[model samples]
Target chain A: MALHFDPADLAARRQAACAAVAARGLDALLVFRQESLYYLTGFDTFGYVYFQVLVLRADGRMTLLTRAPDLRQAHRTSVIEDVRVWTDADGATPEAALRDILAEHGLADGRLGVEWHAYGLTAAVGQRLAAALEGVAVLEDASDLVSRLRLVKSPAEIAYTRRAAHLADDALDAALTEIRPGAFEGDILAAMHGAIYRGGGDDPANEFVIGSGPDALLCRYHSGRRHLDAQDQLTLEWAGVYRHYHAAMMRTIPVGRALPGHREMLDVTAEAMAACLDAMRPGNTCGDVFAAHARVIDAAGRRAGRLNACGYAMGTTFAPNWMDWPMLYAGNPVVLESGMVFFLHMILYDDDAGLAMCPGQSALVTDAGGESLSRHPVTLTVAV
Target chain B: MALHFDPADLAARRQAACAAVAARGLDALLVFRQESLYYLTGFDTFGYVYFQVLVLRADGRMTLLTRAPDLRQAHRTSVIEDVRVWTDADGATPEAALRDILAEHGLADGRLGVEWHAYGLTAAVGQRLAAALEGVAVLEDASDLVSRLRLVKSPAEIAYTRRAAHLADDALDAALTEIRPGAFEGDILAAMHGAIYRGGGDDPANEFVIGSGPDALLCRYHSGRRHLDAQDQLTLEWAGVYRHYHAAMMRTIPVGRALPGHREMLDVTAEAMAACLDAMRPGNTCGDVFAAHARVIDAAGRRAGRLNACGYAMGTTFAPNWMDWPMLYAGNPVVLESGMVFFLHMILYDDDAGLAMCPGQSALVTDAGGESLSRHPVTLTVAV
Candidate 1:
């Protein structure tokens, strides 16, 4: 079974992670974040909801502890050779099994880095694992260690993100073609997702945010599907996911004729987005990009409608969300490095007008500036 | 904004939850699980990935603390009146905001119930929250308090599940029609998802597990869509979710004619599923159903191929997974009750032959036995 990445690439990632652990004075690292695990070993599985842990020793030994169902999955997807399965039977303690694995690796009394902020490591599981390792090992919080390493993408990862961007553009085109007065939101969503899948894109970490009319004012996937009203607003926030690498896009479309405040909102949002993109240079900080967004919106006297953060980092993320670290918020000092992917969304919601105008695009940070990954125009799409 | 259910229905659910919290001697319940929040207040949003908390006081006061993006979302979808938005500004402390909310509710010195096992509460966030409440209040792990109440479905919820089942049947039909030699797995998946949306179903809590060839042996959704071989096995496990209510279905299909071992495996899986369904009576324990599944598979000398748990309780759930509590495992003393839904999958993976046969169905427990929710046939689907 071949891995998702080249063996050499995966090995380099593992070596870098091991070096980071050693530099941090940790003997071993217990990784629970699915993205970190995939980045290190190419192990891609949704079985992390259950008790699954990857023990990466600084000496280059790696072990995966998972359930029986994912045994073959890890074998096929990951390059890790040492794998163990823990039973879900009565009185079965996976924490104990983890302890035994640590003992076998001769790291029972060593300092271990744990991902406390990871979605894979819940409070209950963390508490149980802490109890199991108490008196045997000292657990240190190293949640952002691998995440920071993944901030910059490799050429292969950037290629996947670029492909995902193309798919997102195609999906947006399909959605625009399907949007019409009296068209059901579900049908429009079907068209967008259908185009994505037909383009060979994988499922996104989160559901696409799509709604019509008043529902568009809200940025969530609510229960019921509404029919598009003539001269109504439709908000769409979707991502094209390829190998868990997401390139997100958000655009608010006019169902028929543009409303009174629609054109103004669109123009301001596009200008703000362009400024944010322009500020995403190699040396600029995330806060600098947010400042650019604020300057444009504030100059237009639309600061009340603009969001605090214009964008965030995007990468190979798991479910529950697609948003990554180093968010483009005020006072965030994270430097923008080349090869980093970002989704800059200029979201402005006017409560008085009951209107929402969000024009967003995904881009790759280059030494020169931000290169647009999505080819779709920033103008407000009008479905005639 | 009208809810999916009646106002009275949502009120009753909140009342029940409040009673449960009071019974546990908790002054207030801090709900984080998306399913629990939705069950109690119809607060449906994917924004739970960020820091969001719902405070439900036993004295009938309710408050929701979330980010700016979800303020309108909570108002439109839920009945919660007092909604507070925490800023993402520099030096913004959401924990402080949460602490203030607790103080305002007079729960500062009270025992508060927290969902420590929930995905909404990461270990880092949980730790910060505990630190914020330290010396001011006591935090108790009441993760399963509301989940246990949601085990039994209301009539309105069951109605939604039945509708979702209908959509699942339609989706399966679409998938079967699209499956053939040389067909792309992505296209088949597209067809199924498109059918589901057109049938007015919502996005499922988890990605549909669809794979072919050796990939079918793995339960998780891995990357790469395969072109079906002339002789290949394909597995599909999907659910049709309606207003968060889910009715799941799983089936294994042969691209061409059924192999020699395929029929035998299918027969054994179907028999095991039938036996498990028969044992799902109102008074029987979850283990009793698992025992029946074990007996059937063990008698066939295929016990090693089967999983420890035959099925699990299912209902409204969020992303990352769809499987719910009270799993049908050996020695689990959770008793079956009327209105409880279960998805019994007789998964048999014969790695030696590289063959996987899983026939599953979702059902509702009744006085008469398990009533099938998914109308799809529990037999091997052969696409010739």
Candidate 2:
């Protein structure tokens, strides 16, 4: 039997969110992004019913007002001290609820921070909020505040992620068994897609890369109906989201017998990936870890080593509320702190042939070392 | 048998797009956004392929390049003459291919219009392009270009859209049958999710919304799950993209009997929707159409009538991709020309609840009248 994440744990998560927000020196971080909202409140009800202007005020009052039609659910999944329903009447918008919160917190004269990531906030929401709130500062990056809180996966979260990884591995096994020279990319994708969902997953939740033959040259190649050639390299980059957590790692291998270059390229990438994995630690900067992979490629004397061979933080969503402030895109200097869960992928792409290898490796940072989520062996495959 | 849309008719859509792009006084356009790329290129093998660029010049040279992987499939779909394959060794990224097209067409030395709505060009790609070419201008608004090109729906497009709309309706029917008082929004969404995929439209493409009861109070009132109550209004926004065409519409329904105010609100919205549909016609400005809905709301003496209505362009994708500069959002003052395909959704929402007759109607702007693509009757049905 599968383990279910408890609804009660939402309260603890909310408390953790409150602490993170306060530590960041925010008055009350407006958690509007879906992932952040889910991470903080454990409210997954749709319609943004739990889509809240979550005000985790400095005073420890976790107040929320949602627009869900089922008020009980808003209460069930959330640990908010107060819940308000949005009706079809005037004075019931998020803007209105925000007004009451401001007045109650004596924030009538203080600045209210707004989360800038929502597509719903539209340009109109900003204007409307400005017109509504007298003194408010809508900051752009509340994402980092709550994002850091999710870096260390809860015990439950890791198990769920491992399960997701298992699903991906199982799907890949099925794909390898079913794939043949004459198989269509779309059909093979359909097989993988069906397996994941039937095996208990949101299939579309996992992105797929099932390119074959010469198509594997496209950096972000999409699978198609091309008859897979005998000596083609079928590169796959598919991952699934588990209970809002993420699991991403990829590998590419040959159909029957690989071409000389195909084998060389795959081996080089694997070596680079291994070097990068070995470099992960609690005290390293994002770039330092990336250099591990870059150095491997340079040592191999490849014309171009790797491009963006670094991974960003991964937790509840494919992309969390915000990537850790600094990243490994060269200039970003965000350090790898203990308890950070990063879905790292060292990838390269050729826009011309649409071939890409987003061989991602996800790991959790610890005081001792890093631990990977996937159980798939690093060995390359040659389908018989 | 499902009615298949004719690919031959896409030529007219392309003509409209080419004309719209030219009218913008630009030499060439770089299609980066998925909807625009599909609209122009029509190659739909797993969308989300990395940077498939469609470059159309003023002299009518339309070329699509990205990777060699898609080159063979590209031949089967695209009508464009230059189907260049971008290989890793070729050093041809989509950006590079775009630059070459511009230089070949003498467009590199001047302003080249681009899809500003796209995510930032990847740093690596940007570095390569910027180092190669200097003094290039990027224009942000091509809304007019898309609006005009995609405005008029071909007979084939309309049929596909009609079927798409019906598919959503069919999916909703399946979703509701599984909805019980204690059933979860997540479960209901999952049920519909299975039906849509099994029905053979690939995946749901996006997450399903199953908010009922209090969850309906949220903006875009939908989410993963919440327990449904007998007293709650079950609302859904759904669509299916079949053959790369979008058919979206929404419904607000009660799980059991209508609540005290649900029926009245529904009736008001229905009346408002009817008023808007009746007023749709050619030669009318989008502003005029918006005003027509506002007038109906005003005549009904509802507190606010126009606050929730939608101005949508009809095609394969929803929102902005269907067309260019010819949008129906507020402040857009385009003339409603004949042959345009658009949708009118009149809705009302606040903190307490959301009520509306949505995806109000799909219509073709004609010299004589407005023709609907789908004709499902508007009514409240108690689950039998």
Candidate 3:
């Protein structure tokens, strides 16, 4: 059977979103991004990828304004959607469209919660809208109101995530067998992606950042034309989607022989990961999880760990909706709740030796305990 | 070798974009999308999938305002790129970010041109920007400026597109041989995607839309549990990308004995597609190209002939680019340049026999003629 959001369930989610906006004291919530729009109404068509904005008022009514093509497609996929199409005619401008949607929705005035982080909302649209709507106060930092709502994993979301986890595991296993000496960095990436695709992986978030040798320290480094060598640390941070839920897993392998320093780094990373999970419970503050990892690493005498943070919240799919709350950083004061998901990664950048790779597993947090979500083994594997 | 764009090349493209804006507009041009940014600075990274805006002024000076982390990544990839970091403290709000960037660049009180047709120039950002930069004239439709600059492909870009075209052809060929009765639609899609992945296809924008039986008419319909019988029509639309260059190809096939009406409909589609290709030239209007397909379908006397508006202008990559201008719409008046690329798709929806299929191909406009990018034959293949 095909996977689709039930029309009735969509209405319920919209209502939840509306209530959140009102609770945050927003007269109208200004949604100017794709993830927020898709999260609200399940509109995942190509046309929705524009600077379209939907204003969901406190009164429970909503209106959207976008280009004509997306308007037609948005109507088709959305369970409850209203559109104001903009073309060359009728003074095609974002300001005009924003003005029309606001006036029609009776949101011409009052406090507006804005996603200040989104692009496409130009200074021009802002100027025209302020003049058209008197007393439109903008609210900042309401991301929690929205992010919290999407944090808890639903049953369907978990099922898809589990599949994503399985694909990640399979990709890594393929990498272990294929990441050999004399192989170009691209060959290992190709084999890993091939495994993911065959396992029914969804659109991968990005390309494989396969770093073999000194390049492993710069995790963001693109897989260059470097050959695998003996005693080199191969750090891979790859994830895939199954249906839309994403699973991110990191694995570090010694290409041929394991040096004592590399083996010790992996050991410390594993210990830190386990300690963080030990503090992960329903009522614990997010800081405790961070402290747990930090304490474990500190006790192990590896003070300069690569990661200084905790995990993030997971959701229905990848990229947009699959986000993690930075509980450790930014003083995020939310308690770790049941049904949350995060990736626990540990690293230590040795300024002298470059990036010391020893990051651990990805997992899904439950009220009972933390469940592992990686296919790679916890221990370091020494290649023959 | 890694792809690169020298600082002089960046200067030339920026000058070209600025000239197009001056010819079409009356003020400062705001480049608010990732694709336009990539077009200008050659900042090739996966971060374009997120919220970032690059402003190209009429005077050829540019300012890119994006997330702090993204700013770092952009700088590492491209040598000619310049970026301003925006974080939660420094104008984290869309309006605040727009206001700060505009004020910094000294465009707080001028007419701001925007690429609103694509990307997120979010309404929320627009509304917020209105308050900060008062009395600014906001105009729409600067996408033409970017599109005009992008319409013609470069030599290196064409080489990448050729590679992508071959990948798409190979995937389609693999899928054709695997089509058999009693095969699950899901399993076949998995297999087709597998072939694409093993062939080193693009991680982003490479989507395979496969539909079987009565579900084939949706054009964008994903395959389902619908069993493939001797009477079913299997339709597929798949593309391959190289360094952001894309070439898409689509085809339809019959499982075994084709229905008499199905074979007739397929023949009409194939003929219509071929006729449209033969009509292409260096200087044809987009509307005229679309009209040619309509005439061929009308001559066939088939009421439900090729229904889509053919395809739009194709570029170095695929969608969300202003480069492939003079799209094949009902009333577009842009002319096809010598280096412009286009895709001609003849799709037929036959209700009587419950069959739908497209014979699609891409072409690059040349001095002598438009050359076909795909190597696949357009005739319907019977799978027995």
Predicted complexes: DockQ each:
0.72, 0.11, 0.18
Score chain A of model 2 by TM-score against the reference chain A.
0.81
Off by over 4 Å in 1: none
DockQ of prediction 1: 0.72
Docking verdict class for candidate 3:
incorrect
- For model 3, residues B1-384, the per-residue Cα lDDT tens digits are 223555677678888887777776645776765456666776654444334667677888777776543553466555435677654321246456666777777776667777654334444544454455566555555655676777788776677668777877877777766788766565556555555545555443434556676556545422123457755678777676655666777777777766777678778887777666655676767767777777777888875522446776665442333123455655567776676777777777776766776777777877655678888878778776
How accurate locally, in lDDT, is each candidate? Answer: 0.88, 0.55, 0.62
Off by over 4 Å in 2: A1-207, A210-235, A251-274, A294-306, A318-333, A344-361, A375-384, B1-34, B37-144, B154-206, B216-234, B252-277, B284-307, B316-335, B343-384
Candidate 2: tens digits of C-alpha lDDT, residues B213-308: 555533242223456676566667655545546555566666656665666666766776666565567777776666776766666676442243
The best candidate in terms of TM-score: 1
lDDT measured at residue B7 in model 2 versus the true structure, 0 to 100: 51
CAPRI-style quality class for the chain A–B interface of candidate 2: incorrect
Model 1: docking quality category: medium
RMSD of 3: 5.4
Model 2 DockQ (Cα-based) = 0.11
Scored against the true structure, residue B40 in model 2 reaches a CA lDDT of 63
Instruction: Tell me the TM-score of model 2.
Output: 0.66
Chain A TM-score by candidate, in order? 0.98, 0.81, 0.87
For each prediction, how big is the interface RMSD?
Answer: 1.5, 8.7, 5.7
